[model samples]
Target: MRVKKDTSISLFYDMVELMERLRGKDGCPWDKEQNHVTLKPYLVEETYEVIDAIDSGIPDKLKEELADLFLQIIFHCQIAREKKEFDINDVMKLCLDKMMRRHPHVFGDSTASTSEEVVQQWEAIKKQEKGYEERKSAVDGLPKHLPALQKAQKVQKKAAKVGFDWKDINDVIAKVEEEMEEVKEAIAKKETKDMEEEIGDLLFSVVNLSRFLQFDTENILHKTIYKFVDRFKKIEKELASCGKDIEQCSIEELDALWNKVKMNARKNI
Candidate 1:
């Protein structure tokens, strides 16, 4: 609260002004060359960096990553201003108006005492917005650029909202098992495209199961991927101790090491 009370608003404007200067006639050549399209990768990369900082549980790292993400927003706004479109003020005003409009419990007479009720209210209000009226499907607004796992989960969530979902957790589990069987059959056929498509279906079913259990599929997959990498690196380190290459080892040897490392991981837990 002290930080909020003592925060200087001028710092924000200063950063905005710096971005403008960077994109000006005599400013940085690279900055002047960038448009919203060219800076898309940086925006996505900075977003992940912010997520990483949060996962690391480091406040200072999160603050720095957030600033990097904010720079992407400022960069796009500056480019728009140069093209005679809206500026940062318009962006801030629109966001302010959106929050004020969405949270009617605080800004108006509407009442929502719980978080779930607030989300329902927000979605209801969103459907009444001008741009949202044209959406042909409940899942239409999800960004195409989202990771496949996240996109699948979001699509399932939209469908669930309209009661187009499995009525029981057992049904969800059954769907996953059914997909797995199809995947194995596809692999047995030795058809590459069929195998790929079946694997995708299997993954989509797993994402649905994760959603039913109220877990974030993308985050859970990330944890599994990192765990695999950690154990593999340990295997490589063990091989280095014996002055032998993993590639030179027999499958049986590698499997022996793998079981040992897996056992150690469980014991540590």
Candidate 2:
């Protein structure tokens, strides 16, 4: 049977029913066996894949990945329904309510003419939400599994909101320099524990500097990684052209090839 690709709302409920059947008593054993805990990894993986699809600038791939992510949400809702907890309807309703409540400028009589004002009002509304009112710190609600670099930025941003931040970008730069010196001191003293600790502090300091400068540490690092891989591939191709294996090249030969590749890359840019 062929499914229509039009904007029919019934198709959404049909997909929900499809998931229900997959977990039904007479359905596939693998689908029946999954629970919230067991599906955590795939949920995280699919979310990342959706992000990757978005970054790739492909609409079709984004659509497909979004469906995969939506499936994870549906799977969780199904598990909750089976346990006599809330289901997808409740989830949607809560999200709808929250959206209406948070955007008072749109849904209520509150006024916010600027994007910055809207953000401030949204945060204020969020703090007043039922469970959030008890948050002792602005950084209290960070997801435990967020990527380290992203999590660091969130923590720094939350703290900065409460005025616990550097007064200037130069101050952040100086802190990064101080952390680097500490790392060097740890290495020179051959203190294994201090080295580990100081290295982490140095990374945190760099993350702070990036956040202060309005740069995303993860995205910047990923771009640098992609660049390094591209340069290395070029070097490999150059060596292969001469019928030579990379392992056969000395450090000097590899460096020369790398420089040549770098020059070519610069010229292309």
| Index of the highest-lDDT prediction | 1
Which candidate wins on TM-score? 1
For each candidate in the order shown, give its overall lDDT on alpha carbons. Answer: 0.94, 0.92
The alpha-carbon lDDT assigned to residue 188 of candidate 2 equals 99
Q: Write the per-residue lDDT of candidate 1 for residues 1-269, one digit (tens) a residue.
A: 46553355677888889998998878999998888889999999999999999999999999999999999998999889888999999999999999999999999999999999998999999999989978999879998899989999999999998888998999999999999999999999999999999999999999999999999999999999999999999999999999999999999999999999999999999
TM-score of each: 0.96, 0.94
Worst 10 residues of 2 by lDDT: 1-10
Which pairs of residues collide in candidate 1?
none
Off by over 4 Å in 2: 1-6
Per-residue lDDT over 40-93 for candidate 2, one digit per residue giving the tens place of the 0 to 100 score: 999999988998998999999999999999999989998899999999999999
